[model samples]
Target: MVLSFLALSACSRDFLDITPDGRTTLEEIFQDEKRTEAYLNRVYGSMPSYFWKYGFFDFLAPFSDEAYAYSGAALGWAAGMLTPTINPLHTPQERGKGVYHWGTFWAGIRDANVFLANVETANIPSPTNRERFRGEARLLRAFYFWELIKEYGPMPIVTEPFANDYDYTTLTRPTFEECVNFIASECDIVIGNSNLPMRITTEAERGRFTRAVAYAIKSQALLYNASPLWNPGNDKGRWTRAAEAAKQGVDALTAQGYALVGDYSNYFLSKTDISSAPGDRETIYEVHEPQIDPVFSIINSIPSKPGMFKVGATPTQELVDSYEMQATGEPVILGYQDEEHTQPIYNPASGYDPANPYVGRDPRFYATVWYNGAAYDNIGGEIHLMETYVGGADQLLVAPLGWAFTRTGYYLRKFIDPKLQSGQPEDTRWKKYRLAELYLNLAEAENEANGPTGLAYSAINTVRSRVHMPDLPQNLTQEQFRQRVRNERRVELAFEEQRFWDVRRWKILDQTDKLVTGMEITKEADHSFSYKRFVTEYRALWADKNLLMPIPLTDASIIPDFDLHQNPGY
Candidate 1:
């Protein structure tokens, strides 16, 4: 995500031989306004992968602040303490937390800033078209800055863009609150004035930010502030704004034609399911990777260890337990079993007596996770990620290996597009935000702000109803309603990488530490009891404060004046 490792010329001569009309100007790159607009489009491509790839905010969403945790080797902490899931101050994993005083994010800001500055003076024709282009740049700039804000708290505003010298490291950061205000204010301007569509109508418009995208981001920022981790609404000053922003984000998308698709899997599994794609009715905004670019490959995050499911970032057992069930439209923490004495079967309909083990169970059990020894139509038809070799040796990835930790108890299946072979070149893009999430967000935020009344309850039911989950019981306490909202989010939105962020927003990383389990495996001989006792604890790791990546020590040293004070424990 940092600018490519290759260093290119800061001058345009590298691209064009000479200027026509004897106009040797830097602005020539954006000549005639049309070029300027193209410049804006190009910035999206130029976006650094840092944030998603070990960058500052990358771990923040997945690590801890408040909500839940599963003990896997967490991201960033040295002692492995500061997981991308918990208090991260005391871990060696402190990635360039302070590195921002000068890293990928700042470099990105500099580039985005330059493009935005030049865009301002371009002679674009239609004011509306010009406005849209400018708006995109501003959003990208804001996005870069927001990335900084999420981790470092605040930073110096480099609005002029980074066209200057490497010595630019001298500037100090702004106060956390100031940085928050700047991003929020700018978001409003972009949403208010830009001609961005509520839904993208073309592939070309895929990565552009629309009014709803702006709201979704703004709400996310506000929600962070409202949470205890950031002390956002320390004395209740911003909680209203948090709720208001989340509400606005959802309302804006819906007003512009966003609707929840009837099935949960469609959002991630179907490309023809444009209902959630850019310009598609369900996405408010999304980070679109060009299908042609390797970055667009969904496999990077979905495949196992090195690739196929890198790091096994499945829902913690706690999250799996969070999923609601079929027979009962409630949280099935313990799930359905064989008459409480027979045995526990995840797929009763399959009826392979355990004598056969597959029997009655929660519908989500099979859909959201890959169970130990479960069979599915893989490349050759029936293949299981847990098959054992006939003799004594590690089982193939398709088989149960000899001493495996159960691969965290549950395997994520949501983002796995069947067409994407293990290492094939699949270029379907990764969605950063979709309308389905906005609905769930609205439900959660409203529940938090108003305690499960009117809009809050209705919003939640709309989402749950998608999979036929019944309306939550009436007269439930706020705690009970809120619990439903949380679990609903886990089941309905399992692997699009939302769990990592949700834990942060609510400041409950510790709460999430308790393993949420599901889809257990068992053996058969007497045709009576069970097989294996598996849990997603496969990825569990202790918590620490270094969870917040360390500001890059190099950046801090270079910008001696840039003493951005690293996060506490790191």
Candidate 2:
């Protein structure tokens, strides 16, 4: 009989461990230094690589208003068809049935527990290495819990592994605040460990956890704790905690010589292989996956051409309108006049013309989205422009009428390496946490804690200046600053999986997720284009119940006696 107490790490990359032959017992595995290192790598593997094929192909973009995936789980999610069994956010193990297996995050946590319990017995000679290993395990454990909390809210805080004879039916989840505090404490333990470096500077140690990562985790948790969905009472203390933690996180990172990248557009295309040179210091933590055939970019790069696959994720006009006009540095659209998003509340002073919408937009807009009439490439010294107008090469096609064309009249260009051609293997690694997020976190928390102070203005302006966008007006009120910060996050972190949680945490999904919009362009008689905003998709009903995902039914069924305490409205 195969008696598996914990699932071993399956990731066999250079950093992760490949279980050697003839290692049958836990005693034997931990007795050797090489085996011990391999075990720790298994803990690292527990982190679901969003860059890897399983998570990347169907990312969280479609689950939120950032973009719409024409097929797969995101499409169903957009239509409000989500349930306990059909949740795209939960059960991300794309390779298997949507079971919330302990083998994924729970398995990682279990492995970390095993490592922490047995690392002292390992055959390591270096004291520093042992402490660092312990720190890494603790940090990974904290991170796994954070992931669970973000998706499903409160969860059972199982720090140590359960015994074979342990009663599974007695498991109970802690309160949301308790879970947040527990994660913060775990991160604090790791942050206090000096053995672990602040930055993983070597290429070989590129994806390893560091103090900065722990800090990022803490900041994220605190910010979520203070958000409206969780802190419905408008708890000032929660805001204060979030503000202090974010500020501390920023200070700790900057002290370690980290800052935003010089160029905003080029940051996504920067190297993931950590070089000793001071290049792209913004990425505090990143994840990398081995390159595979028919790279991810092929799906997101462009619509179906002779060699290209259909654009899997298409940008929505709702997202495009978030960009401020460069000429006036003001938002083009204030809000939608209707829930369907067909009628937009245009800000007239911003000089935004519906017919000439593409011009004079935010610089980051050009980097993130491919719209009609925009210059895409220089082929043989001739500028190649995108023709998204009717009958054009990249024409819009409604669902059920087309497969590989843009449903929303735009293609995602945020992470696409413009330098790489079709079929070329591109770098698939993405920054999990970066300096810009930290700055934004600080700005948000500070604004909540102390109104719109100069510090808050400076924190957000730093991010704006990177893209050459004008700083927000100095005299705006607290609510005005708050809106600016949220928009800044939406555009700056577009397609980065931030908006999905932002809408939930801020409790604005009902307003933002009701429907996504798209622009339809038609070539007029004079060869000019006329633009019209149309509803791309109407999302399912987002309510207070949607503030948290339901615990997977499979897991709940396995322990029938246990309450499982499903989130309401599931």
For residues 1-570, what per-residue lDDT tens digits would candidate 2 score against the true structure?
111112233432332333334325567778877767777877776666563232236556777887876665666676666677776544454332223523367878888998898899887778988999999999999998888888887788898867878887777767789999999999999999999888876666667789899999999999999999889998989988998998898889888888888878767765554665567788888864443444444343332221145566778888998999987889998887776888889998899988888889999999888888776553334555777887887788864844567888887766655544542236556689998998999899999989998889889999999888898988888899999999999999988879989999999987888878888899999998888888888777577788777777677565544446466776
What's the CA error at residue 443 for candidate 2, in Å?
A: 0.9
Please provide TM-scores, in order, for all candidate models, with all chains considered together.
0.74, 0.91
Residue pairs whose backbone atoms clash in candidate 2:
80-540
lDDT of 1 by residue, 416-460 (tens): 544444422343445666666666666666666667788777877
**Model 1 deviation from native, Cα RMSD in Å:** 7.6
The segments of candidate 1 whose C-alpha lies over 4 angstroms from its true place after superposition are: 1-25, 32-35, 46-102, 162-175, 232-234, 272-280, 290-316, 334-365, 372-375, 382-406, 418-425, 513-520, 527-544, 558-563
The C-alpha stretches of model 2 lying farther than 4 A from their native spots are: 1-23, 51-56, 89-103, 294-307, 378-382, 423-425, 558-563
State the weakest 10-residue window (summed lDDT) of model 2: 1-10
CA displacement after TM-score superposition, residue 368 of candidate 1 (Å): 2.1
